[model samples]
Target: MRQQLRRQAGAHSDHLQDVLAVQERELKRRFEAAHEDRLRAERHKFQAELAVVMGELKGVRDAITARADLDRAAHHAQEMWVACQGLKQAIRTGQLGAASWQQQLKPLRDEVAAIRQVAGEANRFVESVLTSLPEEVLERGVYTEDALRERFCKVERLCKRVNMIDDEGGSLFKYALSYLQSLLVVDAFERLPGKEQRDESISPKLNTYEIIARARYCVDKDDLLQAVRYMSLLQGEPRLVASDWVRDTRLMLEARQAADALLAHAAATGLQAL
Candidate 1:
């Protein structure tokens, strides 16, 4: 009986020892898992920090690039202005030699191209001041065919020198020239007494019908000033004055003095003739 009791006590002691060993092993596994989880969290935090640093660096790089571009544009604009001035001075002095013409002209060409790229109101003003219109041409009014042609040539030369053909002012100047030419032609015909005396006129083939037709053509082309001038010359003919085109053109020139003056003169002349 004593031996049996001792054996039973030893078995119970062995079972308790096994249970303690299993619990210890479970605790060790949990500790190792916790350590791994902490390492992963730390790695994730390091990646996020790296991304923020890269974003800041990229922003700095972009800002530097933008500033560099601005500086370059300013420098180019300054260089172009200086070159244009030199060319203008050379032209005035007549130092543009045939052999060195291209060399001397290079600067102006470069400047014009640069200015065109940066063409704003300020740049346009600078160009106009640099290539100022000729005093002699502006002073004289172009009346005759020869004078008009000569004036046009002078204006065209100025436009080419200044690279101004595409500008608003340039377009207006060209239109003015056309208007003047049409005015001169109509004036020549009006000076003649009648169709029978057409032989005395320069444009002998242009009768009253042709004159009125030309005026209508000018109106169609949106050359109102020229159209008005021609219509003013046609005021001698009552039928033309009553025409639909004439009425429309008169409406267009409703508040203008030029149109009123022509109508007044024609009425006075007709009264005198009667």
Candidate 2:
């Protein structure tokens, strides 16, 4: 009986040891899984922090770059102004003359053009700067609004002089007149605050007047081609129709069109040449 009791106790001890071993294995697996999940969470947190830092760094870099660009642009503007002053002084001292000044004009014009390109606003800022300059400073060979006007007058006088000398100054006169007219147009457009203010400014009316003047000049020169071009420019503006010059020019153009159509029909029908 004692042996039977010892055997039963040994069996129970072995079964209890087996059960404890299975529980220990399961607890170790659960601990390892929890540790792995904690490590993954820590990695994700670090990656998120890194992404935020990179974004901030990029923003700071962009701001620094933009500031640098602005500084460079400002420096270029100052240099252009200095160059302009030097050129004006040279012209004043008789270093440049009408015979050779046009060649020298290219460099200064390029400098102004460079400013427009770099500033990204085109001619707006440059024209505004020119407008702010004194008339006397502008008159001394600078291409300001007043200066260009003066130049145009001089060119007109030169044309008359050449005509008196029995020389053909038609091309030169037309070129100078066209340049001044274009400058006036650009100046007027720049004067407006926005695209919507185009009609509000006196620019359109001024443009019509300029076109009419060009047409009259063309008529005086007997330049039918240029007159037609000037007339076409006024055709877009219906408001100028009340002007006698506009009315006359339109009538002339209509008469020319009718004549052209008749000539075309005559040629198509093999009629004799006029």
Candidate 3:
């Protein structure tokens, strides 16, 4: 009976140890699962915060880029304005040469190729100014009021002898007459009323007399732009005769316009920057 009681006690002890071991394993598994869940939550929170920070940084980068672009455009605009002023001064003083004038405009052609749309338009205008105008005209053909009157006097004297002809040129007869007329370069004589019946204004029709008279009127007013407009209506020999005048007029007008365009665009850019 003593031996049987020892065996029962030993078996009970073994079963109790096995039950404790099972309970410890189950508790460890549950604790490990809870710890894993906490770690996952922390990782997700960190990722969310990182994403928000990255988004903010990206926005800052974009704003900085835009600000930089605006500043660059403004700089180019300022350069263009200065160059245009130089051109206008050259037009007035006739002191600046084509080399210096074109040097001032070089930036627009080479460096500011990627400038804004408005600046690009200004560049195009400047380029046109260069082509439409001759460098020689910048030094010469600076018209004053007195010069206008004297020039118109000569022009009027010539237009007075004009008559309509269907020929492309002033006709072969008129050409011969021109040679003969050149010999009569004696405007020093007193004029009669019949000789004074010159073209005072453009008449009802579009003819050589009207064109020359109207063009002269505009030229007399020192309005080269208007003068060129009327003069452009000429064809054949008249167009050829007035070609130099037209070119000079185009230069003056184009220079002013180019300067105005660049300055205006620059002013607008400065306003936006402010």
Candidate 4:
């Protein structure tokens, strides 16, 4: 009985040792699985954070590009505005005359048109860029330089035409002297007989009046110099043949010279060149 009892106690001890070994293995497996799960959770958290940061970075880059484009467009518009203002000032000052004003129209029109086109393009670009944003944010006024230049050019051309006509009329008076000279050379008084000249002196007087009439006609219809030349001929006739001839000649010469001087000054100034 004593031997059997000892054997049973040894068996029970072996069984308990086996059960403890199995429990130890199961505990180790559970611990390893828990650690792997924790590692996977940490990796997933890091990946999610990295994706969010990349999205934020892309948004920042896009905003920067949009803002840069807007700045460049605005700068160009400002430059165009300045150019238009300068053109306007030049027109107002009369520094640009009719011919010059007309000539400038082509370039001014082109520039203004180009500016408008560019502004339109820029507006479209801004609109597209801000399509997601509100319209009020991109609102701006449009400028039309071409219209203003057109009006200025028309006025300048009209002024130049008027000036041209005035210059032509003023210069015509210079021809009167030439007319008088021609009359003197022709000796128009010889048209009457010698006896008639001695009688009432009507021949000389008639000759003078004829020359004056001819000169007046030439000056009115043809040229001033032609008239003046004829007038001078009548005035310069031999003093022995006519009375009061010297006085009349001096007066006509003086008047012709004054007109010539006025015309010369106008020509030199380029006012009559147009």
Top model by lDDT, which number? 3
Worst 10 residues of 4 by lDDT: 135-144
Among residues 3 or more apart in sequence or in different chains, the pairs in candidate 1 whose N, CA or C atoms overlap within 3 Å are: none
* CA lDDT, every model vs. true structure: 0.44, 0.45, 0.56, 0.42
Residue-level lDDT tens digits of model 2 in 1-274: 9999999999999989999999999999999999999999999999999999999999999989887876665565555445444434433333244454333222233433443454345546444553443333323323222232333344333322232121222466655664565555534433333233212322334454454455445544555345445544543222223233334334333333332433343233232211
Could you arrange the candidates by TM-score from highest to lowest?
Answer: 3, 2, 1, 4
- Candidates in descending lDDT order: 3, 2, 1, 4
Q: Give the alpha carbon lDDT tens digit for every residue of 56-170 in model 1.
A: 9999999898777766665654554444443334332222443532232222333333434543455555445334423321232112222222333333223223222222334
lDDT of 4 by residue, 95-168 (tens): 23435422332223332344344446544532242233222211311112232233323322232222222222
TM-score of 4: 0.29
Among all candidates shown, the one with the greatest TM-score: 3
The lDDT of model 2 is 0.45
- In Å, residue 236's CA in model 4 sits off its true spot by 51
The window of 10 residues in a row where model 3 has the poorest summed lDDT is 105-114
Q: Once model 3 is optimally superposed onto the true structure by TM-score, how far is the C-alpha of residue 15 displaced, in angstroms? A: 2.3
Segments in model 1 whose C-alpha atoms lie over 4 Å from true places: 1-21, 96-274
